[model samples]
Structures are given as C-alpha cells and as structure tokens.
Target: MASCAQKLLEIIYNRRSIRKYHRKPIPDDVLKAILEAGRQAPSARNLQPYCFIIVRDQELKKRLIFSEWNRFIEEAPVVIVGCGDSRAKWAVVDVAIALQNMVIAAEALGLGTCWIGHFIEEEVKKLLRIPEHIKVVAMITLGYPAEKPGPRPKKSLEELIRYETYE
Candidate 1:
C-alpha cells in the first residue's frame, strides 16, 4: 500500500495554481479520471449537487477572459466550470471540496490545473447559459504546464497552527 503521508504531501505540495499551459489537448481518458475523482469526493448528506461545464471551445474561452485571474483560461486546453445546485445548503462548500479533489487528482495524473475564481459570476452564468438555480462556484483551467512555479512563501507552523484552543 502507498504511504498515506507521502501520497498526501505529494498531492498537496505538487499541486500548483498553474497560470501558463501548453496548447496541446488533454486526452479524454485523463479528463474523465479527473472528473471521477471529483465525483467521489464526500459531500453533505451525499447530496453531490454540482455540475461541471467543460469548455474547450476557443471562441467561448476567449469570451470568458473577462477577469484578470481567469485570462489564462482562454489559452488552456480545457476549462471546467464548477456549479452548485442552489437548493443544497452546502452547495458551494461541497463543490469547493470536489474541485480540490479534482485538482489533486490532476496533479497525480501529471496534468496541471489552476483554480480560477468566479469573479464575474453573473456574466459567466449568462455566457454559459447556466440556469439561475445553479451557483457558479469556481472555474479551473487544465492542460500541460508551460512553467513550474517557484515555491511560494508560506506562514510558519507557529504562525498558522494553534494548539487545542485558540490562544
């Protein structure tokens, strides 16, 4: 069996919010595997109320480049829009968890991914023709990484972690 610690660290540290990507397309099988990982993520009451909109259309992607953070989505081979069913109380939270699962899975598969914030939710909903009943939680650009990001500075354990109680 794989060491859980090693696997977890590998998935967490290896994953980067990639901003640059190769134009080469990802295989359908790889995409399916990533999506399956998301589907398997635990959700509130198992109410996996989320929808994925996979956008590969160049024109549509270009039109989606309205946000500064999402400009790279236009060049990626695939962009996944994670939408939450508004009826579920934990819809956004659940989709966020699922999206993280998908990101880690993509890293394990040697694919690069970046989580794009839903800065223009209303515009994006209209552009994607998504129903009002769905909330656009997040978006992600997926493809082969063009560049590896340098290790970003992180808060030390002492600065971030609190022992039992918040002191």
Candidate 2:
C-alpha cells in the first residue's frame, strides 16, 4: 500500500485544470468535505479572512460567464468563488491557500476542478453580491469531468529549484 505522502504526490501530479464537465450534482457529503478542506486551511493570525461562495444556480452562473473563456462556469454543477477581506495585508495569500485546498480535495475525490481568474471584477461582485471590502481572489468550477486530459509538461526540479538563495 502507498503511504499517505505517496498518495498525495500522485494526486498532485495527476491534477488537471478541467473545464468541460458533465451535468452531475456533487453529493452533499462529498461537497461538505471539499468545503471543510478550505475552512481548515491555515490563515495569517488566525483571521481566516476568506469566504467561499457556492454558485449552483444555472441562471446566475450563466450571467457570471462573461466570455467564451469562462463558458465552463455555465456547464459546471458548482462554482466556488473565493473572496478575501482586503483589510488584511495577507488576504490574497490566505484566500489562495484555502482555494488550493479545496481544489486538491476535489481532485482526490475523483472530481474535476478549474481555477478561473479572467473575468470582470465589477460584474462578478454585482452578480455574487460581494461587498466592496471583499476582493474576489479566484473562482473554481467543479463537476464530473466530461473530458480527460493527458498530463501537461512541467519544469524539472533542477530548473525550478533554487539552492539556499537566488543564483
């Protein structure tokens, strides 16, 4: 049997930015697990200054999809909008961590996830009713994948790693 670390590495390597999705609602328990993963992520000074907006309404999702680049928002069964309180100096970093946690959790559960960032901020805020103080960090689409993509190439460890300090 593979160790937990080994299993996690496999999940990390296998994770893909899935956009196409089948029309299947996530089970309540499974969804809860994914949400909990985000909530449990560590935040600076324990403020946990992040919120996940679960958009399941078809009509609203349609409105959120402002362009062809984001059409997956309309097809996904759920879209989680990760917001951060801009008052915190580390808000962006904190929210990003939590969002990644949810993505990893989804991948581990045989679900597909995609991080979407190219959208009109003002329009999104209006559709989601996000407050002025909260910045929309990123949104992720989630569902059963309709397409399976092969692994994309990545930089080797030698090229990416920096020893001790910048070379």
Candidate 3:
C-alpha cells in the first residue's frame, strides 16, 4: 500500500482541470467517495454552510455549459454544483475548501475533475433552483478523462514565494 504522504503527493501532482471526458457514467461508489471528501473539508469557523447538487441529466448539463469556463459540463456524466448559504458570512470560503477537497479526492480515485469558475450570481441560482439565500460559487465536471492533458506549466518556487517580505 502507498504511504499517506505518497498518496497525497500523487493527488496533488496528477490532478488537473480535465476539460474532456469519456461518455461513461461514474460508478456510484466512486461518486460517493468524492462527495464524502467534500463533506469532510474544513470550513471557516466550521460553519459548513455549503450544499452540493449532483447533476447527471444531459439536458441540465447542457444548460449549465453557458457559464464561463464550463463547456465540459455538457459532456461529463456528473457535474457537482457547489452552493453557498448567503445567510452565513463564511459561506464562500467554506464552499471553496469543500471544492478543493472534492477535486483531490477525485484524482485519488482515478477520476478527473474540472473546476468551472465565473460566479454569475443570478444565472446559477436559477439553473439549479437555488433559493435566494444560497449563492452558487462554482461548478465541477467529473468523469474519466477522454484525453490525457500534459502537466500545466508553473512558475518556479522562487518566483512565486518570498522569503520574508516583498523587496
């Protein structure tokens, strides 16, 4: 068995925002595991003010693709709608942490996930039938990858990090 650290590193390195997916449905167990990870994520002050809607209907996914950076929603078997409860002040931060957990969990389970951003407040609420008190922060397309994406280029640590303060 791989050590926990090894598993974590694999998840961090292998996970990518996969934009294409095979036309195959994800098994129930895997989807459950992914959702479980999101549920276990830490929230600001543990407010846990997020709700997830698992969308599988082809038509709904099609309608969702209109959101920016979310074209893949039209093809993936499942798209997770991350919603935040506006009644709670820390809803946005809580939802973001939960989404990251879901992405990492998908990678660990040999699944690919792509995060769709561009939070058009009104449009998403209507699409998912979200109540006025809930805010839609992001969407994620989940499935087996149809095409393998090469590692995305990144800035070196020195370029991204500062030892003490900005000079």
Top lDDT: which candidate number? 2
Question: lDDT for every model?
Answer: 0.90, 0.92, 0.87
Return the TM-score for candidate 2, rounded to 2 decimals. 0.96
What TM-score does candidate 1 reach? 0.93
Residue 142 in candidate 2, Cα distance off native in Å: 0.6
Question: Which residue runs of candidate 3 sit more than 4 Å off their true CA positions?
Answer: 67-69
Kindly list the per-residue Cα lDDT of model 1 for residues 1-167, writing each as its tens digit.
46988897877986778889999899999999999999999999999999999999999898778767668888799989999999999999999999999999898988899888756899889999999899999988899999899777889999999999997
Clashing pairs in 3: none
lDDT of 2 by residue, 115-156 (tens): 988878899999889999999998899999999999889999
Better of 1 and 3 by lDDT: 1
lDDT of 3 by residue, 30-145 (tens): 99999999999998788899999999999888887665566777889999999999888889889989999999999888889988885566877787789988889888889999
Ranking by lDDT: 2, 1, 3
How big is the positional error of residue 95 in model 3, measured in Å on the Cα after superposition? 0.5
